[model samples]
Target chain A: MTVNATILSKPQVKNAGKLLAVLAAAALLFAAFLLANGADPLAIYSNMISSTLFTPYGIGEVLIKSTPLILIAVGTCISAKAGLVNVGGEGQFAIGALFSTAAGLSIGDSLPSFMGIVVMMLAGVFGGAIWSGVAGILKIRANMNETLTTLIMNYIAYQIVSYFVFNDLKDPDSFNWPQTAKIAHSLRLPRIAGKINLGILIALAAAVIVWLLVRKTKWGYSLRIVGGNANAALHAGINVEMVQIVAMLLSGALAGLAGAIEIAGVEERLRQTTGVNYGYLGFLAAWMAWNDPAVAVLTAAVIGFLSVSGNVLEISSGLPSSAISILMAIVLFAILWKGKGRKSE
Target chain B: MILESLLAGAVQSGTSVLLTVCGETVSERAGVINLGTEGCMAVGALFAYIVCAETGQPFLAIPVACIAGGLMGLLHAYFVISRKANQLATGLTLMFLGLGLTAFLGRNYVSVSTEGFTKLRIPFLADIPIIGDALFDQDPITYLSYLICAGMCLLLYKTRFGLILRATGEDENVVYAYGADPIRMRYLSVIMGGMLSALGGAQLSIAYTHTWIEGMTGSRGVIGVALVCIAAWNPAKAFIGAYIFGAAQALQMILQQQGLEISSFLLMMIPYVLVLIALFAASIKKNGKMPAELKKVFEAV
Candidate 1:
């Protein structure tokens, strides 16, 4: 086919076409992967849909999983908008859990149930903020690459948690398991339906607040300006460094809150596997939303559904849970490739 | 005697990271920052371990590992060079892809054993003092790494192609003006880097550890990338940085074995913490030595 014979289309139409094409390609690729592994693609796909969307308990699990993801994605959206890539969500989340657990263990018995939960969340926010602030300070003052530092910080965070669990936080009565004592029932988030809890509502509220913070405030405007062009923002008398630092802080606080919610809502105690892969999953969700707060919440829910389905696939078809990662990677690749096309245009 | 053994262990541990740093130096010199080095190593380790297990040929595993890693690099290059996608994002995505793919395919390989490369001693050199034993007596891959390091330095500083590669990193337009395709150079360098990184992973499994485990490379890939920066993109300096890091790792293991009061978890944090500190120090200095194109990748985000 001649290049000149190709039809030129409107930007919106072209974008829509690209999206559909990418989705089709990703679906086909995933099907091939499943087929290679001796599983029936059609059956797996239908099972995933039925189990995640059709069943009541499955739906509740989706909402439950989406809580931390939504919160973390909203946080990631803030940083992405500010042109800062925050990969330290895992570390921030872990620290938040650490602080929240400490706070819960101390005053949870004294306060009313709702108040205790609030106190734990607040503690989580503080913990996350401080953990992220380290990277922010390094970036702002030292001109260090936050991406690399944030990633390294994640390993450090894991070690810190491991240290605490193995020594300081290990439940005295527990039989050799490396976990902290379960939080008091008063500190736990109350379930609304099936296994779903108040954490989902909190995550939704966070999304709305972030949307407002980005759309309706002077600080948000300055952040956008800095993100768009640091030199231009500086010329316009904005404190670019301060904006970046604050954005990182806010981003980290959200991730921390995700960690807190996960503990209070599901696990009720900090364990080694607590917050496993949630940070990266949230990062993927934020990117899938193109860093839009409102869209991120929706994307988080979709990914959460898929993740739960991955579990079902493992049990039913013996497919590895890592299959979800392959799916996520394909989606990301397609979007990234499509984005490149848009930029050239 | 204790000091001599520690030094010997440090050299052994550093060999894998040293190879990766050498690879990263080449890629960065060609203006590509591959954050997916960790993922590449994971896939490489799995491939090498599996190949060694099945074929009982440790040497054959190296080429297989390189091919696996080279494919990953080609994917990264397609996005970063051909499509002009964001380098950092593409790297991160590739990392996830590598990890996911390896974990899925390597499920059956875990707990398997292999006939890994055994140590070889240089005749007179091995008989020398403490330093000789540490440096001259090593596995085949470790000896290969020393050659690779020296060869890399010579290739980068003393060759015409090396000049062109460096020019591509500093100014793609200059390379274009010189009638060379900068994009092609970038792709080649990135692929070469991937091959070297895969070799490092192969060494980790086939020469050092001798067993297959999922995610066995851990964050060594990342440490290698960081060491490239700490070395100021110099292959020779990367040698020192790699050894220092390896020494730290060896020290940690020694401390644990000695039953030091420090928590093992805290000890595990050493190399990562060092990377963070080194990165901060590097950043504090003005951006005098960083390739202009590489700076753009970090600044663009």
Candidate 2:
């Protein structure tokens, strides 16, 4: 007699179950870490929620931090959808900031405020696109690994900015601080609320645009095809290389836009350490969202909230801000682990 | 005289990279790739530094650092091998995890000094000529690196276990058919890679710089990763590649010493730029030799 013992469940349901389990595991792990560090997990978590969500200023800070993260995370989504990994977001962001700063410094006084802002944004986009395009072209033409190339490019970008800021762009009136001259007042982004600028709106709009493009456009269809199976896409007569390169350009442009927004909206002047962890944090956000652009927006907000809450934890519990990194790592490990397990089963 | 000094410096700087490359080469040979070398090195460096600082035992630090790194490797292996997660992403995540954990725990250890390894000149070899001083007169870790590199070469090329490891990387199914557990082999190699990377980190903190600093490994761990590819996954060639990068690093300092008027920032870009160029060169050949499993890492997305 033949026995049939297969269990029946919807794929989506199974996936949801797995995700919940992973998240619970991560929470437990984090609680253990908290206890080991001599802090009350319940109290610390409550403080994080109240400080980051209930307070008006805290909400504004969340929006401010989430702006760049949403932009970069969406950029990462685009690249991931094209079967490419663009770790160059860090470098691209730096280049974008550099170009925007340079443009603002050179021509901010000569143009109308709106025109100056547009010019700076355009310059920033072009700079980031060019920086990412280098790696994209190398990958397509030379078969070089984009992951390593993009990471190395980040260091190179930092050096370029450092060279200029230390020598040519030094703010003369700042008493030898390593920073560029402030952008003209007219060129700075207008604040919409307390510590909140129009960049958040731009980020939200970009997310919608990206979602629509990925869900509706023919280009998005081709990108998904390539990411799913390059060989099959090639057999289907899709120009795989072109799709990859264009996706990289678009991905890099978004990150560049984030850089521009951060500089114009927040810093107002280029500093050596601007947009420090946004690239990697955005990467984590995209990964958390499973490369879904729409989900990425929510994920970025959550990450940004946690980031700001890290400061609260630092002050209230005497925990270092870097502790948040361990939380992120645990979440990442759980997701990856669960995702792989479900796929194999 | 300048050339001799440059060569000597090249060897010194290359020691850490050499150790890391050898470690990565072994892991890749056994059908696993651990991109967490940087993270492992960072954590290892911190552990070694703290141990040395607290106990004043420089020798004990190396083993402690290895254990720390091995534990990290075991974690990575559990995810990549047992859980079957994507190796590249997991490696990157581990990198951030290491960076964050070390930064958090190492806050107090920064700027701390300890008893460190000193230069030991081989009596007969030290008097040979320009090459002698450059090669024979070095710290204990440097000599250990030389021994490790040679040992890896022999281990990879001359042993029955080595053949199985190579076969596992080339095709795990074949190894499984032969009744060898590919998963076990992968775990072993990856853990060893972590330990070796940690050893390199210990060398950096205890033998080279002698002081613990945050993110002190800088990008050398990443550089070591790239060197594996540039060397085509061969341990001997990895040794050569490390020294080549070392020479590039040494050249920059030499130029600065000669008052070349270049920005230090630009000089710092040399090794990274060379990595890009080397990657390009390595990729130029479509049929380039690499462990078959490693190639899948790039192509599999």
Candidate 3:
């Protein structure tokens, strides 16, 4: 195999072994945390593993959760490659859901199922693009900190969604609950098996496409150059600002698609709480995978499993579901700790 | 009367953000952006609330909260300085760790109440006009916040230790050449930042809110980070910046009280939107030179 092809493959046996060792260390640390919290680590860990891996329904739920995570992570990779952090994925996702739902509501039963779904997805994409575009524009024009702007906007977007749900989007048939009416039946994604829909496939396909684009395209080359050193890219006659902005837009668009798919494929209605924390989780998944789309698929699944296990921890160990984040953070810390010397040197 | 109440309310609410901004200014000047300041604040608030609830002494919670926040800072320092992890990633993870850990540990303390610090109105100052009520007749923590800001300014600009700290942030190698330890300086600065941020959180819970609540800081730590940037990393400017945010929050409440019929959600966005506007204005005006290392961190994106 070519050197590039070999490099593109998974890590060698030794590296894989080291990764496993690191993961094992993280698991041990997490066990200590559970023990300190008065939970039986062995039982909790066993329950987490058995329930998530042993049941078909659990597997289906894992895939469903991973679907958005995969899509959002792929999008996160695009922005990370361009040397930007899109932590606003949460806000963008919320806005995307709002936009898609608005479009779905407007086009209710008027068009064929395929056409309606396409329109909704398109609306979602534009909605996310616009939401993230604000930060991108601020970065270029005002030189504002995108991280803070994006974070603040996440709250603003949530409030906006809440306002709509409580007012214009409130389900009239229901008793004043803050949620939009369910979309037309035809607008829902076709279920492939059990709780699984076509979303997983779509997410995987998007990941592959992103991987190819980032690896092979001219824009990808420019993105790498810009990310490496914007000054150097500017010296090379590249429009650094434009490239970064496009990356932001594309990243947000993908996140928006995740929001839309979530609405059609999972929630089937819009609520203020729809897709909560998915953005942050997806961003973490991308970071865990080091922003590589191919590796992101695996990382997304790992995050999804841990997230599902968080719910299990709540049920079995009587721990708050948020207890899972401690585990997640510890695992990430271990990874960062392990990868340290290599990057610094 | 409205203006008087508004200014007084601004001082009351601004204390927490002011403390955090000062802490962050010190940390960032030492060349590390602890995006986990939010986490530190959250952890601090919880620990402080716990201490206050258990002991019925809000003052005792301050030191405990500082220690708790310092531990978080040490963790971030270990990852960024010793392990050489990415600062942004480390900080974000620290934030999640803080949030999740607080939610986990604080679940039982949700409904607990404590005898928090009450405003200690200065006798002469209380009789003065609007400014006295705004500045002097306040909780001890709020008063301490003003001194902390001044002390931070002096520490960053007027002292030998401050010079070394600022020098370390600008160029670590240069400081190393001078026979100083940049690593230790960064750790100290970060820990100090964490302590101050925690103190802010303590003020929020034991003085302002008087009750333990999950996610109570409400991203105020982030606002602290933003204010630091807008202040151009100057502690003094951050004082003003914090009050501006506090006024925005105060305006929201004032408007709601007046029966203006605005949506609560829209009103809730005011402080955040004001941050965006302030950032825009600061960027346009070229407010101040960001610390050399801090600039690199931002440009690193």
**RMSD of candidates 1 onward, in order:** 3.8, 3.8, 2.0
Instruction: Report lDDT (Cα) of residue A310, candidate 2.
Output: 79
Clashing pairs in 3: none
CA lDDT, candidate 2, residue A264:
90
Q: What is the lDDT of residue A33 in candidate 1?
A: 91
Put down candidate 1 lDDT per residue, B1-301, tens digits, no spaces: 7788788888898898999999989999999999888888888888988898899988888899999999989998998988777787788788888888888988888877777798999999998888898899999999999999999999999999999999999999999999999999999999988888888888888888887776788788878887888888989888877887788888888998888999999988888888888887787775338798997886554
TM-score, per-candidate, Cα-based: 0.95, 0.94, 0.96
| Best prediction by lDDT | 3
TM-score of 1: 0.95
Error of 2 at B223 (Å): 1.4
Kindly list the per-residue Cα lDDT of model 1 for residues A78-112, writing each as its tens digit.
88778788888889999999889888888858999
Fnat per candidate, as a fraction, reads 0.66, 0.73, 0.72
**Tens digits of lDDT, candidate 3, B72-126:** 9999989888977778778888988999899889998998888879989989977
A254-292 per-residue lDDT for model 3 (tens digits):
999999999988998999899988888888788778788
Q: Which ten residues in a row have the lowest lDDT in candidate 3 chain B?
A: B292-301
Clashing pairs in 2: none
Interface RMSD per candidate (angstroms): 1.7, 1.6, 1.6
DockQ for every model comes to: 0.65, 0.70, 0.71
Ranking by DockQ: 3, 2, 1
Model 1 regions lying over 4 Å from their true place: A1-10, A340-345
